[model samples]
Target: MNRSSSSRAGLALIGVTSLVLAATGAPASAAPALTMTLSSTTGPGGGATIVGSVTANSVTPVPFPAGTNPTVQFQYVGTTAASSACSASAKVVSPIVVSNLLTTAGTLTVNPAAVKRISTTKIVFQVPSSPYPVNDANGNPSTVNPNGLVLMGGQTSSRWSVCVYDSDNVTTSTLLATATYTLAIKPTITSILPASSPAGGGQTITVNGTGFAATSVATTATAGGVALTNVKVAANGNSFTATTGPRAAGDGLPVVVNAPGGTVSSLDPDNNSQTNDPPIPFSYTNGISITPNQAAAGTQVTIDVIGAGFSSLTFDAGAAPIGSGAHVFLVKDAYVANSNRGVAECTGVSVIRDTELICTLDLAADQLNPANSATMPGVAIAEGAYVLTVVADGGTGAGGSANPTIVSSGATFTVGPY
Candidate 1:
């Protein structure tokens, strides 16, 4: 039975082999043949260049072999010292572009190797793939790196290589040309906003400037002798908004704006279009007083008062003790005080017409303390060497003066005991 099975298997093999030989009209042991060559290469910037050529040799063109994609690539491997092969490996910096071929010559492929730095004058590049048959107008395959192919900052150099490939899965690349070139870096800033505001603050305050990047802006201000609140900066680093308590009625309560760059002061330009030029300064005048200077304690003493330097002709006593319900005086004193302070009441005691009293007053206060008390009862009797101390209310009887207190001896007053 085993001998019979072996004879049957031999007959089947003979029949299959006869069919294969009849179909191809040739022996099954015949080997298929293929060939490929390298073409050309080019660089993007102005650095180095490579040229490749490829050709494929095969009996049949119909059903060509498999992979065939030709490309050219460039890389910067830096300079080299004398004897040794350039220290570094070549990096493919540009994308591969397929070369358009005119004729189908078998199959071919090209692959670029590392750049070879020979010296300042000469450099070598390797075409690791097969060679092809293709020529440029100059009878040589020309290679070029486009002018604006920027790898890092500016542009690529003219020195580079191009790769060529055929349909037979073969490749070849070569150094085509060389060029000299360069690269550059770009500029930038970091913040701007108000640094401060007033406590009893008003709207219409503006805070904006330029040159801000990653940092934050800060705003600050003093309100009613206290620090302001709700200081905020916008996310874009462009502007800032803040609300502060009412301002104390004096100069130098600054609304400071700060960033990493520097600090700037802000002012209310809404009321009268005032320019906040630094060191030039701005002011609000607290009115001054004199006359009927002697008033009995607890009596409603009405002294004439006059004011200047006010845009609206109104005074805001920031921290002054004088209340809103007090009466105003009608008198102007231009003979004393500078324009900024503009002659308000002074601190300490003084004499007036036939009276002596204690005078320690701050005109910036909102209301007088002790109610209607301006003098001590029965404190002194003097025919001479008596001084008068008068306080000004923003009312009819309050007299306005540049400087309220008379500094000269002729302005002295004496008071007799009640």
Candidate 2:
């Protein structure tokens, strides 16, 4: 009799469970019979608008009534299960609890609303940042799980889902479907090359970093708070380029890159690494060109160098119009072959205009003539193919050794046998 009673109790329990499920209009078994998908898996911190649609396969799901459209209720939770909540199995509930964090109405307008079903519902809604939880399925508010972790403080991701309601209203609603997605991560910038350019802008700069999207529509590069132009991203997505916008001289503002995920500034550590993005070193000049293409050895020749950014320096414009303590050099082609053996370091650089400089090359003999030593007589030039490099030092004294900030570009010239 005892064994029979036990068997009967087991049957009774199963029947009760089935009746409870039937009354709620929910399936007795949890299966992915209803498929749900979100338009995108990632978005910004404020939130992202996600469009979702559901399709039913084997399940003969519940149909929404004619007067009532299906509803999509969103929930921000710690768990990934479509049918379960974070607070369900825990012996102690977390500090965070949310229900119905956000909601959207199904809009498939068929002649008869009654014919509309969960599988046919389509809805759009936004998912917000974390630390703030959303309402649970029961339409109750959720709070942070004190015993768990805090996610909203950084570029972190949390599980978000939308549940399809059999009825247009959330109250007394039956969950027919749910779709899960991961929150988007913020982008980071590591470096910007050609760090500084003329204040006039228009320089093509290269930005290197991680988490950059594939198109300009998804990314923006800026200098001194001004937006750049012709922005292009690399195939690897690790770098991008943009033409700088005009700005005043001085240490121009930080370079910045903005994306849907997040904004990274030159002020931020490189890709969140320990290093910082190098500052933009703006100036009044940029290029160099030497006049009188060629000269023979032993000839006293004066060459004119033209370039911009030679004038209107930001600070330390001591004595020279180009700025105080600035030094310019006409290094010889030999310097390229070997710095130590070259006599290319031409001295006595003279500034003729903010944008121009004059250098005298003493092709006379091999060494400085004591009578003209003060002019720092130029080094002897050999016959053959050679190029001269123009180096500008924005510092005090020769070579501007005091302050090493230097801007240089070249002009190639040849010397014939004298």
RMSD of each: 24.1, 15.9
Q: Whose TM-score is greatest here?
A: 2
Q: Estimate the lDDT of model 1.
A: 0.30
lDDT of 1 by residue, 37-106 (tens): 2222222222223322222234333222333232333232221211112112222223223223211111
Clashes of 1: 134
Highest lDDT model number: 2
TM-scores of the candidates in the order shown = 0.21, 0.37
Runs of candidate 2 exceeding 4 Å displacement: 1-43, 47-127, 131-185, 189-210, 214-218, 222-229, 234-238, 241-255, 265-293, 297-308, 313-418
At residue 166, what lDDT does model 1 achieve? 21
Q: For residue 64, what is the lDDT in candidate 2?
A: 31
lDDT of model 1 at position 416: 24
